[model samples]
Target: MIRFENVSVTYDGAAEATVQGVDFEVPEGELVLLVGPSGVGKSTVLGAVSGLVPHFTGGTLRGRVTVAGRDTRTHKPRELADVVGTVGQDPLSHFVTDTVEDELAYGMESLGLAPDVMRRRVEETLDLLGLADLRDRPISTLSGGQQQRVAIGSVLTPHPRVLVLDEPTSALDPAAAEEVLAVLQRLVHDLGTTVLMAEHRLERVVQYADQVALLPSPGAAPVLGTPADIMAVSPVYPPVVDLGRLAGWAPLPLTVRDARRRAGDLRERLGGQDGTPEVSVVTTAPPQPEAPPTSRLRLRRKARSAPTTAPPAEVHALAVRRERVQALRHVDLTVAPGETIALMGRNGAGKSTLLSALVGLVEPAAGSVRVGGAVPHRTAPPELVRRVGLVPQEPRDLLYADTVAAECAAADRDAGAAPGTCRALVTELLPGVTDDIHPRDLSEGQRLALALAVVLAARPPLLLLDEPTRGLDYAAKARLVAVLRGLAAQGHAIVLATHDVELAAELVHRVVLLADGEVIADGPTADVVVASPSFAPQVTKILAPQKWLTVAQVREALA
Candidate 1:
């Protein structure tokens, strides 16, 4: 069992305790969920358990923490290495080896395990995590989801008594997230591994969690309860769950099938004329009127540009040749004037690679990419700035200026943009303490937001983002959705590669799934996400697969 007794931990050079008064316990083999907004001490709780809090982070800890009946303070991370396994939010941070297979064996080898034992454990872990095929693949070639799975597998190879993960699915597509979650579920249920994880995408995980430990931001006591009880009070919830709550559904179905069964009567009562299941569409208080429908501006908030009805003109995007990485397999894809396309797949699935190839950052070995009728590399530097923009998965690449104000200014200046326009954009988008503080000093979540804001300031016709909301808080995430929706409505061709299935269902029209550098599936977001091969649909979809995308869309479609 693991226990945090009124724990409050403060890091050196930091102003406050990342986690404060966290009190919780995980009984043996119980799957526990530690959830909260980013930077709210969720990771800190994991640190306490793994002995990274005071041992490595140099924090002032005020409470006791015990794991497996042993106080964590007395045991360093190395001492607890064999007993407690932890995978952090950033998979790259934990990786030390050069290849996938070697990384798996690194831990076991260090523990002086026999070669046979190490080989058998590595093979078992690879198969268990669906990574057997990629055993020979380089770590750098895997998708973000695959890398995260590898991180989990690397830890699990030791068979630790307790396993802790920090937002393991935040970087994966819906299908990949489901794959990882399914493995974790099996571990806890079949293998009896004590599992504790903190994740922002609650819809996919809440149902499987045996215990819910919610820390509602700092300065609050952690709220502990069963999944049902926690869902009743959580401020954040998936769209269907929220709808169920408002509609007064009993026991509040966690999956779509359950909701469908419970909602039949409600649907009938709403009155049906056509064959549609009949849900209501409240036309009242419509969101801000549709923005202009032109690719030069917003993408989603606007209707498809009238001229875009003509078949989209295809343009070549990227070309690359590398020693061992076949990043793109002579791929050809087109983006209509205002389409929102989500790139989904496991990590190293070439989602990030495809985005890079499009942006001219990573050259494809076999084919080339283009944007707005011109090759990305062939386009003039400043011209390329306006035609396409990219936000790399690593937010640091987007950051450069000392202060947030300066960062926005630099981005605006990049495309030979106007100061008034840039200032206007910065003021409206950032519009907070970001104006004065050093951009680099902010947390990863804050940096990501600022970077996105910077990208927006450039006003590119095509916007590409890789896991934009990886570290965002709930409110911030909602704001991001609003921004992207506004962009799409305004006429920008927005292409996002994300693991956030629920978000894609809310915002996108189509999805393209890549595996092993090949396009496995490409079609309407609704059609594909509903029955994605890698993952069953989100609970909302399971509740109502026909309405697989968003609650508003589902409700409207049913009506």
Candidate 2:
């Protein structure tokens, strides 16, 4: 359905091509996953299919590109709208209307579909994506995941033959991500629609792909094959693949079920292992005396031996209302010095709200939020820097300067740090990025690194990061883990609101699960994740009942 022949894309002033010799084909009714390291041109390749690379993005495209037999070289994006639907990473950029229902119908109206057909498709999409209840809601008021669904449904209403999606599930929760993937699966099976998606969260989509295309690096040829064949050698892969490799399983499994089927012996080998290690810090709240004996024993054993007079930060009965919605309700949390905590939940569960409250972006209606003994909302901006710092979900929101060097300089000035502190942090977090490049021109991961560097410059006592791994590849994510770990070890309390379960399993000491607007569960990482099937990492699912939550844990046990 889509074909790229000897395709190469060179931007306006770049010395080398962003993508070169990229040849791939997606058959009718199939889902092709485009994956590579950050800045390896996966997005460039996906854009070429819809005639956006050279036409809309101001780049030079060489060689033939066709979608549904229409040559992209001759057709612009608008001309191919009926045959192609492209949803970029930023959902807010895709919306042209204020309300959900209007956004859903806008594409159909533009396509000039019959009134009855348009109405039918609108209703069908609303029901398919569980957006019926939100039809009258303003697009800006919806959560990030809700906006993502609306963006997808807007395009699907037009009934395009090909769908090109970039990081479709990055903002979605586990259930919502599954729902979106299921919708894609149905489109491929029931409607014979072809999909080309570039996503960084491979663990959510790798098992659903019909074909895997690996772009090793920029200007290099793509390697295409079945999922297993590509995953065996691909640098970027899901945790299940890592577990399979660690266990020496032949023909690495793509899904948890397949790995679970072959994990009986490995489970036996790790039979007596106690994978849940003790936490390094104590909670500010007193333990419940009425708890069960086993639970109490476990908590006592896992609790730190050293006592702390006060945590670095604390949230007490927090309640936040945004517009008409209560984004958070009676939420209580504590961040101890030298601790790493992961805040996890479904979409619209108030994780972002909590982070905002901690960072003083949102004021609590009822309860208090204190960072380093001062209420965050009442603290002054200049003083807040030394108390707490946050790396927001949309990394670009924290960036305003034109160039990377300027942004770093601004960060240094704002934080009162050494002249080159931010730049040095950027070098440590994300190496090899040219200083002169515009922050807007950098890939999503690079932009995120810049934002993180800006936040870390202050060296705050408490750190809050929301979805920090959104666009990061495995290597970048590893570097991030190490950085965050080092910060925690240096008396900086870290809290990350993320949907990346693998990250939570591998990096965090504790997991805090939120639902609706309340804290539902909070415990050790292994205990919290292993209990929830939807939130468990792939390795944990495969090694169920063994209490092993990550490949590193399994590797340690095996050794």
Candidate 3:
């Protein structure tokens, strides 16, 4: 069990405590989900359980945090390694070994377990997390989802009584996320392990939480209750909860099956209605008039009333090979101007590769890739920016400046824009970001926002984003939806490679499903998602046989 008694954490040279008056306890064999907006102290609270807050992070702890009756204030992280295991947001940083089997055993070896015990636990963990086939695979070569599972399995091998996970499923696809959640469920029910997890994608894990802890804002006291109790009033929630609230369900349903059981009357009411949701008009202040526009900027046609049209970016017989791995195999795809497309697939299913090819990050071994009539691989960097812009999976890879302000300034200089142009975009996408804060010190979501702002400064005809909403909360996600939607309206083609099905349903007009380095399915959003149970949104599942994909759509139809 984990307990926090009047815990408050303040970093060095801070105005006030980042987390204050937080009191909660996770009973043995239970999973507690920590929910809050971006920049809230969710990660700070999770770090306290394993003594990473004041011990390694160089912060002052006001009260006590105990795990399995071991006071973290008195004990260091290594001292409590036997009973506590922690995994941070970035899985790559957690690995101390090259291969999966070695990584799983590293923690046990550090704990000084006998070789026999370590070997048995390694085998057991590989099987438990369904990583037996990939035990010898190198960690760097694994997909994002696979790396996540490996990171978790490395900690699970220690068999700790308390597990602390920060955004455990952020990088995983829907099915893989379900597998990870199912493993946690088994641990709670069968092994009596206590789990404390913080995640931004609430729709994927809210149903699995034994209890929900809501952290409304920074330095605010947390509210603890059942999932329905917290979601009824929580600002950050899934579409199903909103739909439940709209329909006045007595108790908010956490799962699709539960919502569907109570949706019969609502379904009949919306039987023969058809209407599009009234999208809010997102406005931005006028750009600084001093900036000069770059050349080769072609005016694009507006969005077509029909779906069939020649795409701005196209891939024909695309085959990519890297280090003996065939990432893409004879793949063909296209993205039309003024259209938003969702790229969905399992981890390592060529989603990132496709995005990379579009932006010229990866060279294809065979076939051709064209973005606005220019071959991305052969296009020069300066010229490519006018044609396409990419926000890669690792946001830090694109960031090198010391401070946020310097990064934005560099974006303006490189894009030939006005001095304050990049900063304005950052304000629209991510508000309240301090100009002096070091880019390394910001949270995962904040770093992603900064990187996105840098990419958007170029105003390329085609924009490609891979896992753009990894750590963004609902409010940040809504702002991103508005920004990206605005870009699409301006005749820019957008392609997002993500696992968040709700985002795909709410924003994109088309869905392209890939598997094993090939395009398996491509069609309209409703047609593709309604047929795939794992990728379907909660509202669509509840309103089945009615062809609705979001709560906004349902509300629009009813109105």
Candidate 4:
């Protein structure tokens, strides 16, 4: 029901079109997934469907885009609201009301639907998305994942024929992401709703797509095919696909069940004589003395040995209360220098709150938090900068400067580092970001890189990141993994709260699982994740009864 005929879009600013010669069509009642690396104009394609391209974003539309027989060029977003629903990358920008229930109903009200119909749809969406309990909660008070659900629910209540979504599950936990994807499936299968979604987390959404559209690189025309076909040749793919390619399977598998079915022989090849897969061991030495402070942050690969220094961060029976909710309770943890930990759980499991407590963003109701041997909440900002730094879930929270250049300069000043130190980090992490561009104009992934660079400039002994890979693609994520691994080798303690299980599988040395504000599972990465059904990566699931955590491990073993 959506068609793009020779579509090309160029913003008002400078050079060429962001997307060129893009032509595709979505059959009625089908879900099409748009896949590509970061900064490939996937968002631009999605925006075009909902009439946000040139209409609201001030770009030039070279070709025609029609949805359900309505031309987006002639029909502005407001005029096409009846038939199209759009959800952008950031959920906070979508809300127009205070409470969850109100936000869900706002779209229906805008369409002038009858009060009874609106109420019915609102209740249905709330139940579908599992937001019934959060109906009365303020949007600002909800967690990032919760806000994302509300944003999706708001668009869904209108019952639009065509849905355009950008990273619908980026902020959601695994189970929550499944629920959202299932909802989209039902909408397409049972109700004849058409969906066009662009997402970086292909592991969560690729298998569910009816067809796939791949934008190979920046300003490249899209190529369309079946999920399996596209994944076979696409530069970006999930772990299961990587495993399939490694094992030389005839057809690549998209789902765990399919991969598991084809994994019998491969499993035998990698299995030990006892019929169990050989376990991979990761060891770190006891803490050593603290290293001398450096002039500026630099990426260097040191030996993967833990230092014998004192722990950089210590949390003892930490209890944190936000408003009336006890966000965290009786949590005790320690991070030795040159160690990396992944804090993971479902939404509102207190992972973010725990990070906040470490950074002194939230005060503990009971117990204590220490970073670099100093009480976090009691330390001054200037002193704290040298001890700990946090890149929050909302990367924009740490960004305040008008331009990229100004932000880097400010980071250097705040961190007491050499000039251009932060700029160098930004260049390494996210290349091609000009100094003149505003932080607000950067893509979600670009903004995140800048925020991380700003924090890394200080070279704090303890580093904390929340959902670090939210918008990063595979290449960018690889760069991040390398950079973080280098930091850990340099005696920096890194703890990241994330829902990206693949990231946990590939980067972290340890996995700490939290639930209901309490630590439930804490151990080595392979030990913790391989044991959990919900948290296991695709490779682990496919090669079950085996201890494999990543495709790279499997590749190394086979080689």
Candidate 5:
């Protein structure tokens, strides 16, 4: 029920179209997944469906885009609201109401639906998205993932014929993502609703798509085919597909079940005495630099030799209360020099709250938190800068300068570092980003890199990141992994709050699972994740009984 004919979009001042000659068709009742690297116009393509591209975004639209036989050019977003529902990447920007229940009912109210029907639809959406318990909570008090679900439910309550979503599951935990995706599946199969979604996390959604549309690169026409056909040649793919390709499996598997079905012989080949790989593969470390050791490197060497060195960060009986919500409860944790830890759990879990506690953003209601031998809550901002740093979930919150160059310069002054140190970190994390670009103009992943660069410029002993890979594609994520791994080896203790299990599997030395503001599981990465189906990475699930956590590990073992 959606068609794009000879489409191309160019912003007001740009030289070339962001997307050129893009043409595709989505049949009614089907879910079409738009796949591509960041900045390849996946968001732009999704915008065209809801008429946000040229209409509200101040861009020139070429050719035609029709949804449910209504031309988007003729019908503005408001006019098409009856048949189309769109959720952009930033859910906070999508809300007009204060509470969860109000937000879910706002769209129907705008559509002039009967009050009874609106109430019924709102309740259905709340139950469908697992937001029933949060119906009375204010939107401002909810977590990032909770806000995302509320945004989705707001759109879904209108009962539109078409759903256009951008990174719908980016903020959700594994189980919550599955619930949202399953709801979309039910819409497509039972209700004949159409869904067009663009996402960077292919592993979570690729197996559920009815068809796939690939935008290979910037300015390239989309390639449309079945999921398997697109994944085989597509530059970006999930870890399961990566494993299938590595194993030379014909007709690459899209799901863990399919991969496991074909993995019997391969499993035997890599199996060792204790149901683990014979050679333990180290996938997180980057190659050592050849340059002379810097002061930070020397400090790392000293810490390694000095076993009595204090941990970078320590927490005991930490409890944090936000209004009536007990965000964290009697949690205890520790971070050593040169160690990387992943804080993981379902949405509304205490992961972000714990990071906030360590960074001194939130004062602990009970117990104590110390970073670099000083109580975090009582430490001065200037003094804290030397001991710890934080890159928050919304990367934009850390950025304020007009240009990338200015931001780097400001970071250098703030951290008392060398002039080019921050820029150098940006270059390593995100290459080819020019200095003149505005922080607002960059893509989500690019902004995240800039924020990370600013935090790393200080050369703090303890580093904390929240959802660092939200907008990154596989290639960009690899660059991030390399940078983070290098930092961990240089005496920087890193703690990241994330829901990306693949990232946790590949980068973290330990996994700490939290639920309801309490730690539920804490142990080595493999020991913790391999035992939990919801938290295991694709490779670990595919090669069950083997403690492999990544495709690189499997490839290394086979070699």
Candidate 6:
């Protein structure tokens, strides 16, 4: 069991506490979800449980934090290794050996377990995670979802009583995220391993969690309860739950499958199954949102800018090498200047790898990459930085400034952008909290805004974002869409790699589905997402399973 009593943490070179005076418990075998906007101290909480907070992050933590009856402060990671297994947002953080088998065996080996014990555990994990086929594969070659599975496999081999994961699926596609979530569910349900996770994509995990601990927006306390208890109050509840509220269900449905059973009744009661869908739960067909528009920034494309470069937009196939992993597979791809393209695939599908390759942060193993007729590798680092701005899945990784204003200033300066222009842009992206003391201190949603604000400061012609809504609440996601719509309107080519089908459906002109370093489907967003039949489903796409991505689009169709 893991416990936190009035625990709060602050890091070095950081201004504020990530979590404050939060009391919680994770009994053996129970799955607990820690969710809030980005940087709500969720990650910090996980880190504390695993002894990474003070040991690795060098933070000043107050109150008591214990794991399995052991004081975390008294035990370092090495000491807690056998008792608890941990995985971070970035799977690359813990990878040691190159092969999947070696990775799985790494932990057991460290503990000096017998070869037989290690072998049996490794084999069990391989089968459990559905990684038996990839056991011989190189760690560098696995997709993000695959790598994350391997990470879990490696830890599970140790048979730790408790497991903590920090946004493990942030970089995965919806299907891939589903795959990982399924594995996690099995671990918690079948194996009786206690699971504590911090995730931004609550739609996928909320139902699976036995307990949901919601950290209020910055300056507030965390509210703890069952998933149903949190759904009604959480700004991050999925559409079905929102619809459940509209349908007047006493308690909201937690999972899509459960919601579907009663959904038909609500629809029938509202009107009929034949003519335009009924509206018992919500007033409109698409179910207009109760969230205030002010919580989000909604902007439609004003006009498409005509670029000097004519048709036959450049196709650059670049290579990327991150540490030991050659992330990009030297794949061929092209982007039309005015078109919005989405990079899709399972996690570690190399979507981010490919994007980084285009920017030259990821050195390619082979093939050439060019952006706007300029070779990315040959271009100056600063020039490449300005050519493309990437909003990584982990917002905190991108933020490091005294205030929101200062962060924006640094981005502008780095991009050689005009002074104060970046600050002006922050107003819309940040909205009400633009003037906040420290962007870091805001709620998870606000922090994401600040991070995206900095990335936009570069004002790059090509925008590359990785899961832009990783930790956002409902309001924050709408605001992000507005920002992207505004950028696309200006003819800024945007390529966002995400698992957010709803955001993609509304913002992307086209969706490029990738699997195993290959483009399996590439075309209009509606065609790609709605066309899938065998693949696992996403919430936004599930309820309607239509071509539309937003409530507005559904309403338009009904009208």
- Please give the CA lDDT of all the candidate structures: 0.69, 0.84, 0.84, 0.86, 0.86, 0.68
| Winner of 3 and 4 under lDDT | 4
The residue-by-residue lDDT of candidate 2 on 147-171, one tens digit each, is 9999999999999999999999988
How would you encode candidate 3's per-residue C-alpha lDDT over 382-469 as one tens digit per residue? Answer: 4555667788777898888998899888888777668887899888877877788788778898899889988787666678889999
lDDT score of residue 534 within candidate 4: 92
Q: Which is the better candidate, 1 or 2, if ranked by lDDT?
A: 2
Best by TM-score: 4
lDDT value for model 2: 0.84
TM-score for predicted model 4 compared with the true structure: 0.94
Structural similarity to truth (TM-score) of each candidate: 0.84, 0.93, 0.92, 0.94, 0.93, 0.79
Model 3 residue pairs with clashes: none
Error of 4 at 86 (Å): 1.0
Cα deviation of 430, candidate 5, in Å:
2.7
Of 1 and 5, the candidate ranking higher by lDDT: 5
After superposition, candidate 5 runs with Cα above 4 Å error: 278-309
lDDT of 1 at 490: 60
Candidate 4 lDDT tens digits, 285-388 = 43443432321222121222222234688999999988867889899999887889999999989999998888777899999898777786786665555566
Worst 10 residues of 3 by lDDT: 295-304
lDDT of 6 by residue, 1-559 (tens): 9999988887765566756878878888899998776545677788899998889878798998999899988999899999999987667778999999999999999999999999898888887777888888888766656777788778889888898987776656666566778877877888888999987767677888999999867535689899998988886766667657666776788776776667565445434444332211111122111111010011111122222342212444545565555555547777655457778766666787777666655555677777656666576643345345666655676777778777766766654457875677667655545443665556455666677777676555677777777656666677777777766665567788877765675567777777656667877666576677422234333354323344454344434
Q: How many Å off is the CA of 110 in candidate 5?
A: 0.6
Could you give candidate 5's per-residue lDDT for residues 47-71 as a string of tens digits?
A: 9999887889888999999999999
